[model samples]
Target: MMVDDRAGRPATSSGSEGHVLSTPTLLGDRYQLGEVIGSGGMADVYLAKDQLLGREVAVKVLRDPEPDPTDRARFMSEARTLAGLNHPHLVTLLDAGTSADRPFLVMELVRGTNLGEATRRGGPVPPQRMAEVGAQVAEALAYVHEAGVVHRDVKPGNVLLREDRRVLLADFGIARLVNDTAHHTRVGTTIGSPAYFSPEQVQGLTVTPASDVYSLGLVLLEALTGERAYGGTPTEAAMARLNRNPEIPSTLPAGWVTLLQAMTDPEPTRRPDAQHVLERLRALAGGDDAAATQLANATQVAGATQMMTSVPPAAARPEPTTSVPRAEEPAQKRKRPYWAIAVGIVLVAAVIVALVLLGDRGATVPDVPDDVPSQLRDPLQDLHDSVEEAGQ
Candidate 1:
């Protein structure tokens, strides 16, 4: 039987409502809750300060009491899975314990937004930024895979970006420890975001590291194209994964397109592992640098070609008149026309302007106010005064 929660129905276990504790305040003594950061059907995350460490941290608390044996087992498994991971690109699990009647996890508080929010507001990031993020995430996955864990829920919403722009994979609540199959049997249904789920996950097959890579490919595709690789409603996102092929974005870089295609291959055996993906992305980034250099060289060659073509041909001299006869037929000297001179001057000026524009292409120019002197003790005083006046 299922019981209806705030959103809808969820699998229910036999437990009294009194067993679930109400919200308790433990701010300054243990963790100081700043505000609610996020909430979902299963848990709510809060921005808090860890009094013990004197640093900010995020606390995620289960929505209901873990009195039920099944729920308690699953919660314990999650804690064990997180405790086993120690990677720079993964959110550090600081502490986990039962507070009051709810099970809670303390994690590193990321200052920046999640990938989902970033992509929605800024569209796709630059290729270089995407590659950097992808590489870090791949490395994080590799580390976790080596530890014999499979992250069943890898998606954009679960990937956090730190203030320094580093990627931190979050939400290992559903991750299964390799030896915890007994606990996994209790968690009845799939626990991953539909849009980024691997095909095997949709088919109810056991998840592996390659499954993580498949999901990572979906995330990378979204990061590069500002759109989901599969088209469907939110509820249908998982169903779409069962299809043979996902649509590739037309605007993605050639190398990235190839990488994503390999990652999202339907057959888990055919898909590349996290380590392989990391190496490929690193190589792609290096190749991009070389390609940029080649483009610059090509542009220079084209400019040189244009300059050579524009040069006037060598002046042709009439054959020397061996015979100095026929003085009457004096050679009429053609005067250089004023219009020709004007045209030449205009061409030279245009070339100078073009060169100036090209030189400024990659240069950063500072903006100065008209009232500011070229050199002064406080040239910015007028600007400050203007700002103050505007505020007034």
Candidate 2:
């Protein structure tokens, strides 16, 4: 299911007769709601017009007229977390308020499909584009994590790909503040989408920024392979990760292989942080060898573990290094061949014998060439004189 940040399958709510909005369904007295663009478990998103700003915005209104207290708190928590974050890669929050007793949130409407749809419509994305997507999403994750927010949902459905080649991470409805101890999940239940959950999330452990990285790794792997990391029912998908790590394809470029493997490591501490992920992804996107090399070294130093079920231990894996030569440096050292030096010596001896024969015939020998080596000249002259005496 493609879950748009603001749009999805129609969710029947009290506000309108199904997905279409009733005439002039105005909220906050400043925005006019139109047709439903997205729907989720919590809210229904509509393409709305902001009367004050005279711009198009997405309005997400609570689906239930009388929601549970905890659900309402989590919905409002998303608003608060989004309000504090102001990153270019993250969707911007416009407004939030209660209208007609329904809590609604206004956000900038991205004018393109989510990554889920894009990948499905257009099969496997190229390596460069995948790198760009990963880098942009990782950038958003780094910012949100630094702001003390953990985006519990980071699947392809939550990532929007704008028409202008820009990426925006959306749908923080299940986001949790890192320091807040209050648990949001019900007993024996998880929060995020099942197929994208990290190992820790599968085990009902604490979720962190690395969890987002693992999810993004799965997303990128799916994008490249055109197959979900985990398939089947929600429970089946969630339980699959606990026993095995997602299989990263061997055909992928080395940089992508290293990054995806490290990101999806079962041990949370072995996964690279969002910032480091961002740096490496950017390097991959830009084809920057130097930056890639630097990040690879950092990944090794940070003990970025590769969680491949079929592979041998880390010590057995070959060391991956980039040794791109600079333009100023020579490609290889010039060396004199042994055969060429031997041929030169033979030619010099033959030339000295010829000079001695000329002097014995009363013919003046030509002056030794100045190009000859100083030490070789004396030896050649002594050999020529001995040959001349033998001829006499």
Candidate 3:
């Protein structure tokens, strides 16, 4: 359910068997396919009518009708994995089968845009709302972690924003099934999107739930900052992380700065577990459950309405819109630019160290990111940069 770009591509119908699909197609004599809703690298999702169930469902069909046994096995693994998860923060897997050896799955049609679209439309999410969304996603991640699964790919594109303005973390590791890294690596293709890849994953180490937490941290950072922490060519972005930490901006709520730093810590072991992350985020959301319940009900109503109406093709919805972040917090609460305080702390520490080392020599301190490692911000580097700045 990575319902946006980068998780997969949109559909291209060449023919019925190996190419594009036709509308009004019947699958298993029970589901009536309408228009193609979403498409990714390996599958095409359609808004379809579940005739037997008397409801609308998102039907995902494999593009390759005659995929090899390995592909089939991987598809079945997604089915098996999804069958075990029943969290409200996840996309519900309804049914699955093969027609002419083409695999397809019937899913609960979540009538909402993905987080990528939402963020682009709404800009940076408000602090409280970000906490609510992140908490919901973390809760889902906690459940899957307990179930012994890792959502290797956790990005904004895979997160859905419901009509009620809440969100759900979708796909639950399904991307790993189709994103075969071996061949991609052989051809110099990145194993995953560099902007969201964890350090361990980029390093080719054994990925665990910790990796998922790292990816989640990046996604949360992007949602809150209205910017990606890393970019450039895939290799450059991934390798950049090996030397430096994410820029936690000189602006952010204090709690968010602390929580995000902990979550995105260079050492995976230092990062908090999903449940702990969920607890912290829930605290940030201000212990509200009634509002969340109302949001869920809104989503249910929206889904029901979509079920009754005919869905337009993906092209018809060129830009999916989302609700603006609620900006009604009282003035007593502060949120923006908390990272300025962090910078101040780093500056004070640096000055104290410089005074101790310089023995009262009057010299200006150089500016740097708050979290720059001591090794990179060594005395020599600072002296060199300071001298260079003075000359300029």
- Among the numbered candidates, top TM-score falls to 2
- Model 3 lDDT per residue over 141-225, tens place: 8888777666777888777877676677776424432223422122343444678888777776656676778888889999998
TM-score of 2: 0.72
Colliding residue pairs in candidate 1: none
TM-score against truth, every candidate: 0.65, 0.72, 0.65
Where model 1 places Cα greater than 4 Å from the true spot, the runs are: 1-24, 27-29, 65-68, 185-188, 287-392
Q: Estimate, for each residue in 135-201, the C-alpha lDDT of model 2 and write its tens digit.
A: 9998998888877788988998788887677889999899988777776556665677999999778
Residue-level lDDT tens digits of model 1 in 95-117 = 87777767788887666667777
Candidate 3: segments with Cα more than 4 A from true spot: 1-23, 173-191, 287-392
Steric clashes per prediction: 0, 4, 4
lDDT top scorer: 2
Query: For candidate 3, what is the TM-score?
Result: 0.65
- Where model 2 places Cα greater than 4 Å from the true spot, the runs are 1-18, 288-294, 304-392
Candidate 2 has its poorest 10 consecutive residues by lDDT at 325-334
lDDT of 3: 0.65
